[model samples]
Target: MSAGLLATSPGGDVLVAAIVVPVIGILLLWLVRPRAVEWVALAALLANLGVAVAVLRTVSSSAAPVAYLIGGWQPPLGLALRADGIAAVFMAMAATVLVPVAIYARGAFGAPGERRPMVFWTMLLAITAALNLIFCGQDLFNLYVALELLTFAAVPLVSLDGSRETLKAALRYLVFALAGSVLYLLGVAIIYGAYGTLDLIGLASIRGPDGALLLAIGVMTAGLAAKTALFPLHLWLPPAHAGAPPAASAVLSALVVKGSFFIALRLWFDLLPPERAVAGSTLLGVFGAAAVIIGSAMALRQARLKLLVAYSTVAQLGYLFLVFPLGLGSGAAPFESTAWTAGALQLMAHAFAKAAMFMAAGLVYEAIGHDRIAEFRGLGRIAPLTVLTMTLASISLMGLPPSGGFSAKWLMLTAAFGEGAWWWVLVIAAGGLLAAGYVFRILVPAFTPPEEPIARVKPVVVRREAAALALAVIAILIGFLPLAPWPLLAIGRIAAGAP
Candidate 1:
């Protein structure tokens, strides 16, 4: 055992609270009145958000990982939950996004004693607990369990309305996710058989280009790609996200897919040697480039607002995988490179922007009674705040200046220039143009003048509008980050060899 890896840090108990508080809220839901479900869920999530921020602060100040070993046992014999810099960032991002989502959902799921509200709140809490595990898990088997919990929690939200189309979509999502799980588990088994240890730090110390290790990584990456809905394994995402309730769509799109993607990052950068994975990293980049092009084209063709947003998610996710090739190919510690910072910024930016966009879509549907893009003429007049939310989010999604998307792409472009990787440069530029095309498709019709005045079917609450807009503004605020490699991201990264 690496002695450095076994010691728990001060304030490490916050990690335990991050997972436990939400679980407690899940249990409290049944005991509270139906109307109190929203209160219980919100209180727990708020507390969880504070915990996430505390973890980030501790890691930032200490410049090291914060860890808590379960039962004081070491890895391979017992489990450890560790929060490295990247994990702290992911946790903080997830918590920040979840709070706004919970607030926005109150308008829809806050009614007293309703079955749907109960189910939604319960699943929301379940997802919170599962995501905490995913960020803190230190071994493959534990990560697999967290992934399964996230999948199960998210699937019910997809079919919450119980419509025939949604049920079918939910089933498809579940099946594909389970298939991914099987492959992941198989990889974990192979790793244990070959290395006799599953702890990430332990694996990193011994990782090599051994055939068994290579095979395990291949299968595991394939599985995580399916779970993350990376094209061409992305068929399940559009239907599932588009058909769900808007609040659910926000969570599914912004955070759930990221859980799997985070594990993929750990696998490729932590458990595999970067210098040796050149070919594999490039292959992953190729798929990401394909996802950017094809996913954007599909989004441009979607007739409904929600479906357009869903496909946009598929396109946005492609940028993340590009970091693998850009960082690993740079001939530097992947975690210390600008590409790595760009990828983290991209993830945070997309979470806030996409969540806001989905909430706006739901509000649009509520006002106009339909989400058909063509029928959105005069949307600005009927629901100006919702339209404003969409516009602000689009600014980020289109990679415009003074927004998170812009900073991420700018850093990525700089990294590509440094490496003289012109092919990737072209892909990044083209992806931005295509993103602009789809964003305009939504904005143009919404701003168009109606032959006659359009009336709202239902009134939109100011609280919900503020909630969505707050998320969008945060996406923009992230642009203020210096367009360079972040030192915080480097903390504890070398210990596990994670980029």
Candidate 2:
């Protein structure tokens, strides 16, 4: 290892802590009595948030990728951990979404005496650990482990209610996810055989556009697309996401699927040569556009509130894939980097807004005893605060002005115009319109006066409503950020000679 690389700093240590601390908390919860688990989980999440903020400060000040070679061993011999601008941003986003979910779940999951609450907290921690690992992992094999951990952690959450329908959904998700793992593993094996190393930085230097490499990229991407629930491959997503508890649904839809998508982005842009990416990128984008149309249509037809939100997730994921064609055009331009950041910002904004929406939806269901959309005719009259939060979140989803969704759409539109890809621009506009329609479908009914005064089944806690509202407000506030490419996302570009 070079002397420059070995100069360890506090920033690097915090990167390790962001992942390790949550796992430690999970261990403590298992070891301790059930009564203490929720408090322990909340404390760990708060501490993890502090560490994430520290990491952001360190990276922003240094303006360099923070690297930590585990156990003092260098790459190829031992695992390495790294956080560049993108990783830090995502880590912070995850922490921000998680804290509120933790708070909301305290009421939804109930006291630690029940087995369900304990299991929910434990799985939440495991999911947190898995996501941190995915973001920070520098080795391909290590990332595979993290991906599997994420799957196992997330699958249980879908069936946490122990209902037959939820159980069926969990099984379907498990089967498809396992198949994805197989394909991804096969790609990893090919890469290992061809390049003799699975480290991302190491392979970036040696990988090329050969048949083996292309095949590996194709198989791996196909696998990840399934996990990401892109288009025709998204059959399992609606049921799984809608069946899970609201907190779990928020985490699953907002962040869990994103983990695989992040890996696919790294594989295409960082690992593969530019020329080889054209066909695959177009194919992915086609599916994405289809998802936007199909998922939104399905969402409009859904009867239940949570199901509608789940289908909306399917539609939203499609926009992420559109980045491939718009960002990396036939010829490069100065705005390419801007497009990349726009896509990332979209992911971040969606995470916050969707999580808030789902949590708010959950609170509504709790108050009304059911989630039937038609039956919620007077929801605003009963739980005005929760309804207000949902309205704010829907504005972001509909890409209204002064919201994060608007900022993301603006950048994506700019990229489309710059690249002469008018189709994507049309897609973005149509998606916004469709989003507005579906959001209004729900809100219109909620605002209408009921023939008879709707009786509230239960009273909602202010703190839970406040937590959901705070997240929605953050999503709206992100729009105020300057509409330019973020430098942090460009800090650790996968150059030809980095490894």
Candidate 3:
């Protein structure tokens, strides 16, 4: 292990709490009366949010990685939980999305002593703990365990309604997830056998262009890509995400897949020798490019609003892998590059925007009793707040100015231009145009006048509308941040360099 890896930082306990609080909440859910389940889940989520904020503040203020050695033992002998700037950002982002989702979920899963409610709340807290662990875990094997927990927690949410179709979708998701898990575990075994350690920092210190290490990284990348639902490996996402309840859809789309993607990011940017990964990075970029075009085109053709948003996820995820070629291939440190910051911003912006979009779709369904895009005439007149929420989210999704999506894509375009990778520039431009096409497909019809009067099947709650709108507004507000590579993102990274 690196010498610095031994020292535990002052606020490291916050990272522990970030993971532990949610687990405690899960336990309390079973112990407490069913009447208090919602309150218990909400309180735990709020406390976890506090821990996320504390870790963010501590990492930013100190400008270093905060490490918590398990049982006071160093790596190769024990485990460690560490949060760097990027981890802190991701943790806070997950918590930010979760709090509102818990609020929005109250309608569906708030009923006391119900089986679905019990399952939903338990899985919600499990997801929270799993995500916290994914963000902070330093050992590769430990992350595998975290990833498995995340998959198990998420699978139940997909089948919460207990419909035959939903059960099938859930099973399909499980199969894909298990396949990915096997590949990932095999890679971990390879790494451990070759290096005698699974600690990422220690592995980085002695990493070289060895065949075993390269092959292991390759296998691991493929596994994580499947779990992340990246293009060509994304057969399970649309059905699973679109079939779930509205709140579940938001959590799955906004947060779950990101856990696997973060592990992939660590593998490519943190563990591998930079020079050895360029060819593979370009290959991943190819997959990303295909995902952008194909996924958006598919989304444009979708008749259902929820499925459309889910396909949009596949496209948006494509933009993330572009960071590999744009940042890693630039000869600068990946953490310091414009593409890196752009990728991070894109992740944050998409999480907030997509969550809002899913919530709006759910509200539209609630009001009209269906989510068919063709029948959404006069949506603006009936549920104006919900339509407005969709509009705000669409702004971000289409990469319009003064929105987070715009900022991220703009930075990516700038980086591609600097690298003279005009193919990526074209990909980015086409993606924006295609995104506009799908987003408009939903909005234009909704705003159009109906042939006859349309009555809402149910009244939409003002607070739920506000919860979703708050997330959309945050997505827009993120655009106002300075359009530059952030120093905070590079803090505690191994490759801090001028891009």
Candidate 4:
């Protein structure tokens, strides 16, 4: 069978379902009673998860990219939805994280009546649809639309509670995201004028090291970096993520920013030539290293639990950019496979672990009435399960043994050594140590006894704690996989000669 039809030519149908099912849920939410919104959202997400799993299985088993020609026309003339290995992995990750976020949102947002549960559900579904669209988009223009959808969906999530502080944060996020959109659109225009095509594969076939291409790449990368909240451009992240509700924070930190970073990865590694990638890779890595240092330090200084986790996300994103340097360098030993897999694994691991941690922290805040980290003493007595979940999730974040974070770090370290990029190895190690410090900052106080009788603590829900623990366990379990390159990641990559 041809590659396009490998999934019984059902790939396109599944892709559309993945994107449309959530959108349909969003529309249905407005028509349905508010009390039923959560159930509908959950059902839609579960269905999306099944579709995502099916797509992953089909792509991995086929070991090729799955393409769905829209309106029965081929690329450059018509739009297409395509899922390669990376896209499949991200789709699955987003689906996995959304399930827990949806469950958590039930209590946090409240069901129906007065609090506008329908609006929350609608935004959640919209966010899911946008993320899936970004993952599957094969054309640059289509991706731009997906990104706009994501930003709009995500902005409301920040201020779901309608608080003044959260509204301010949402506004800041909107302004910065708009700036990024303008820059990205300008870059897309340049690319279209230069190459007469916006399809990634089509452009890759004819791209050259010219002023137009380089200028476009620089503008696009900067724009994506802004959207991703990478390092120096992270002015809006800490406040926006920290101010949102726990479920919203988890999705924002864990998956939303990653949608843009994934595109940046594609722009450099898949679209640009090896020679062009070298200098650009180093520049990106330098920014990544700085983010690791600066973000980790900022995380350590945060007084609030949610704010600390939010800043940690800023640091973790830096690790993703390191892939540019480690994977694209020509002088590097042939460790591209390991670097690619490691970067991807880091993305997945961080998503699961961070989401769990944020949810767990939210539970803690609900129990304690506030999220001040220093005042978390005696929390273990009140909510052992939630605290335990936080600890487990932190283990992964700190890159300790038997957690996905450790596996990702080990592979990245190996790739760095193979390439003689000792500086990156040191940066990775430093980031881990800083992560340990910040994680322990919370763990120690939560586990320790209070100086006096604990004040009235809110009741902890068993189901909520279980939901958070499940995600943390999944993150830790991924570490047990063999410590080597992951073949699943390489499936469906564009062939060297393919357009």
Against the true structure, whose lDDT is highest?
3
lDDT of 1 at 301: 98
**Candidate no. 1 TM-score:** 0.98
The Cα local distance difference test for each model comes to: 0.91, 0.87, 0.92, 0.86
lDDT of 3 by residue, 210-236 (tens): 998999999999999999998999989
Tens-digit lDDT track for model 2 on 1-499? 2321332455698878988999999999888787788889999999888988887888888977788889988778788888877888888899889999999888577667687988899899999999989988888889899999999999999999999999999999999898887889999999999988888877777666689989998999889988999999999999999999999999999999999998888888778777777777878888999998888889999999999999999998999998887666646632236678788888988998999999999999989999999898989999999999899899888889898989998998988887788998888899988989888988998899888999899999999999999989998998998898887777766652343
The model with the greater lDDT, 1 or 2, is: 1
Q: List the lowest-lDDT window of 10 residues for candidate 4.
A: 1-10
Q: Write the per-residue lDDT of candidate 1 for residues 378-438, one digit (tens) a residue.
A: 9999888889999989999989999999999999999999999999899999999999999
Q: Please give, for residues 140-170, the per-residue lDDT of candidate 4 as tens digits.
A: 9999999999999899989888889999999
What local lDDT score does residue 96 receive in model 4, on the 0 to 100 scale? Answer: 90
TM-scores for every predicted model? 0.98, 0.97, 0.98, 0.96
What overall lDDT, based on C-alpha atoms, would model 2 receive against the true structure?
A: 0.87
Counting clashing residue pairs in each candidate, in order, gives 0, 0, 0, 0
Residue 391, candidate 2: alpha-carbon lDDT: 92
